[model samples]
Structures are given as structure tokens and as C-alpha cells.
Target: MHEFSLVKSLLRQVNEIAEQHGATCVEEVKIEIGPLTGVEKILVQEAFELLSPDLPGSDCRLTIIEVPLQAICNSCGKSIVVQNFQFQCTACGSSNIRITSGDAFRLLDVTIDTELTTGVTEP
Candidate 1:
């Protein structure tokens, strides 16, 4: 599935960030996937779980946050919380709408463990 590719890319980026910070290991990875992005949660989770150990995210926990679609009705000028893929406006029953969010796949944050440095000189 394409989820594998996405996870691979995500891990690559995470590795880069961890390396830049002199991290010895990654603690956690937080990401948000919107409904419209078409990235299946189960597949992504599976991929991440299987691949995390081999990547820089060894012993890291992957958190996937599902984001709901938010849209605004163009005709009625009303905000709508879309559920069950319903694109129509509930207040005005209009199909003219613009999606404000929920169509994204983003890496929110990463926690890494850096080497413990001591200023004392070993004699």
C-alpha cells in the first residue's frame, strides 16, 4: 500500500531531525492525518510499527491523530463540521462549500533523546 511509502518518508524526516539534534534515539513521533488525505489509519499504524525499529525511531512510539473535516458553506456562510463524508451544508442544505481543513498529512512533533553531556573532564 502507499501507506508504506508515506511512513518511510516520515521516518526519513524524523531521522534527519534526530541526527541534527545529536539524538541517540527517538522517543515518540506525533502526526496528524486528515480524512480527505486518504491515508488509512490502520495501514499507517501497521507500517510505522513494523518499520520503526529498523529506522531511527527505534523504541519510539507513533501517535496518529485523526483529524475531522471542517468546511464552510459558501451559500449560507455557515461553518460546518463534516462527518461521514457529508459535504452538504446542514443549515442551508447547499452543496457549495469550501473545505478549511482535514485534508492534510503532517508530522506534528518528535521527541528525541540526546547524549548526556558532562562538562567535567575525565582525569
Candidate 2:
């Protein structure tokens, strides 16, 4: 599944950051997922759980934040409101619209814990 790949990338980034900061274990990973990102939350979470142990951040927690779809009309240059997945500009009847947000899947932050003296060795 695509979710598995996405989670793998996220874990890799987190591990990289954790290593730079000398973190022994990752405690939490916050992610922002837009509604129009076309990714299922449950699937991503399941993938994260399945893949966590294999990565450096074994004990990390995944937190997902859902963002709404906001588009700007190219014709009228106004925000298009989404109701029931209907994306259309309120000010004008224009099909030419540019999506502004709600199509993003990214890691926001990573929280980690580590000992003061020893660094976490990569596995």
C-alpha cells in the first residue's frame, strides 16, 4: 500500500532528526494530512504500527491532523467552499480553479527521549 511507503519515509526522516539530536527513542510523531490528499487515515496508522518496530523509532506514537480542502478560483480569485466534496467558487461560476490546500501529507514534528550521556546507535 502507498501508506506503507509514506510511513517508511516519515520514519526515515524522524530517525534522521533523532540521530542528529541524539535521541534514544522517539516518543511521538505529528503529521498533517489534508482531506484531499487521497490517503486513508486508518490505513496510514495501521502501516505505521506495522512498520514502527522495524525502524529506529520503535516506540513512537503517530498523531494525524486532518486539514480541509481550500481552493482558489482562477477566474474570480476567491476561496472555493467545499460541501459534500463539491468544489466550486462561491463568487463566480468558474471551473478553472487552483487548489490552495488540503492535499498535503507531511510530518509536522517529532518528539524524542534520550539519555544524557550515551547516544542512540543506529540499527
lDDT of 2 by residue, 1-123 (tens): 688888888888888898898888888999998878888999999999987885454667889998778788999888875656677776787778887777888789988887766565757
Local distance difference test scores for all models = 0.88, 0.82
Best by TM-score: 1
Candidate 1: misplaced stretches above 4 Å? 118-123
lDDT score, candidate 1, position 34: 90
Kindly report the root-mean-square deviation of model 1 from the true structure over all alpha carbons.
Answer: 3.6
Query: After superposing candidate 2, which stretches have Cα over 4 Å from the reference?
Result: 55-58, 117-123
